[model samples]
Target: MKQDIHPDFKKVVFLDTSTGFKFLSGSTQGSDETIEWEDGNTYPLLKVEISSDSHPFYTGKQKLADAGGRIDKFKKKYNLD
Candidate 1:
């Protein structure tokens, strides 16, 4: 509850560079760059490498390793099958 000791928290725009997605949210992070949002207002712009839109896990496009095949190969190699 101290005054003048906390970082400024304000609405900022986070840009996902990979998917070109933009969202407005509150953040304490600062940026020199500014962007015009859909609301016709300029806000601080922060560029990010990945976001939910382009992430494999969120989009259900992640490739899971074939553990069953690996186990079979290991069993064959060790003659445990």
Candidate 2:
């Protein structure tokens, strides 16, 4: 453990832009804007493009690729059976 050589780990709020969800966590990053979190304290707000809530894996809403149909395209180009 060293003194005065570590980043300033502070509380930050992550705002999911797509779902409008907010979660509080700690980070070393700083922000110009502050928000009143559910804990009734003002913290730096950071906007994120995607999170598990809106992500395809956890939600099982992933976009399915046309595997069978696209196989022909790949075979024709590569000249494979």
Candidate 3:
């Protein structure tokens, strides 16, 4: 393996922007922002729109799509039985 050819994989804090949830994980992504974690250590801050903390599936609040309605609409649009 070549040296210095890979991205710097380090610990980064992923903040859920919507829910304000934060967690520490390793990533190769870089950020200009820094955040002091609960451990009193500063790490790169990566803001994400959604995370498992606030995701619909994880929270069990996902809305069931109206598949029947969509099928009926499609059939009507194309005049298919």
Candidate 4:
């Protein structure tokens, strides 16, 4: 409720390079670059390496973390048959 003490929240675009996706949202995040949006206004453009679209969980392409058949190695070591 105070004036000049809060950050200006405005609509900005987040660009995901991995998936070439652009999203418009509001935030107080800072950026050094500006971009012209669809509304004929300029806002800070934030570039991110990953987002929901490119993430493994969202795309259902997650890779198992096991290295060199760790599950089989463990079973063999313990003689679990």
Candidate 5:
């Protein structure tokens, strides 16, 4: 509960660089850029490389490794089958 020692936390717009998705949220991060949101207000604009919209895991596009094959190979090599 100290005064004048904390960074300013305010509403900022995060833009996904890859998918061009934008969302408004509170953050302590500062930016030199600005953007007009859907609410007819301008907010600090922050660009990010990846977000939930374009992420592989979130979008169900992630490739799973073949762990079963690898395990079988290892067992065969060690003669533990």
Candidate 6:
């Protein structure tokens, strides 16, 4: 590995703002904020809009919207009994 060629990979805390969910992981991303984790360690805090905890797919609360009317058309074409 080349020295100083890679961004700093360190432990960081990712915060899901919507769900108030937080997790710790290693990343090259840096943050100006800090948070005390459950392990009693301080890590760089990175705030994000969504994560697996709040995401539709992971949470199984996905809303399948038929914006273009294609899905509805397809279902109509098949003719459900």
**Candidate 4, 1-81: lDDT as tens digits:** 778998889788998766678888999997889989888888899998777877797888963444457888999999986
Q: What's the C-alpha lDDT at position 36 in model 3?
A: 100
lDDT (tens digit, per residue) of candidate 3 on 1-81: 889998889999999876779999999998999999999999999998778987898988863344338878998899998
What are the models' TM-scores? 0.70, 0.70, 0.70, 0.61, 0.71, 0.72
**Alpha-carbon RMSD of each model:** 9.2, 8.1, 7.8, 8.4, 9.5, 8.3
lDDT of 6 by residue, 1-81 (tens): 778887778999999876789999999999899999999999999998778988898999964444457777888899952
Query: Measured by TM-score, how close is model 5 to the native structure?
Result: 0.71
lDDT of each: 0.86, 0.83, 0.87, 0.81, 0.87, 0.86
The lDDT-based order of candidates, best leading, equals 3, 5, 1, 6, 2, 4
Clashing pairs in 5: none
The weakest ten consecutive residues by lDDT in model 4 span: 62-71
Which one wins on TM-score? Answer: 6
Q: Compute the lDDT for candidate 6.
A: 0.86
lDDT value, residue 14 of candidate 2: 93
Compared with the true structure, what per-residue lDDT tens digits does model 2 show for residues 1-81?
Answer: 879999999999998777777889899998998999887899999988677777798878963434346878988899998
Runs of candidate 4 with Cα error greater than 4 angstroms are 1-5, 62-81
Q: List the residue pairs that clash in candidate 3.
A: none
Cα deviation of 4, candidate 6, in Å: 2.2
- Model 1 collision count: 0
Model 4 gets an lDDT of 0.81
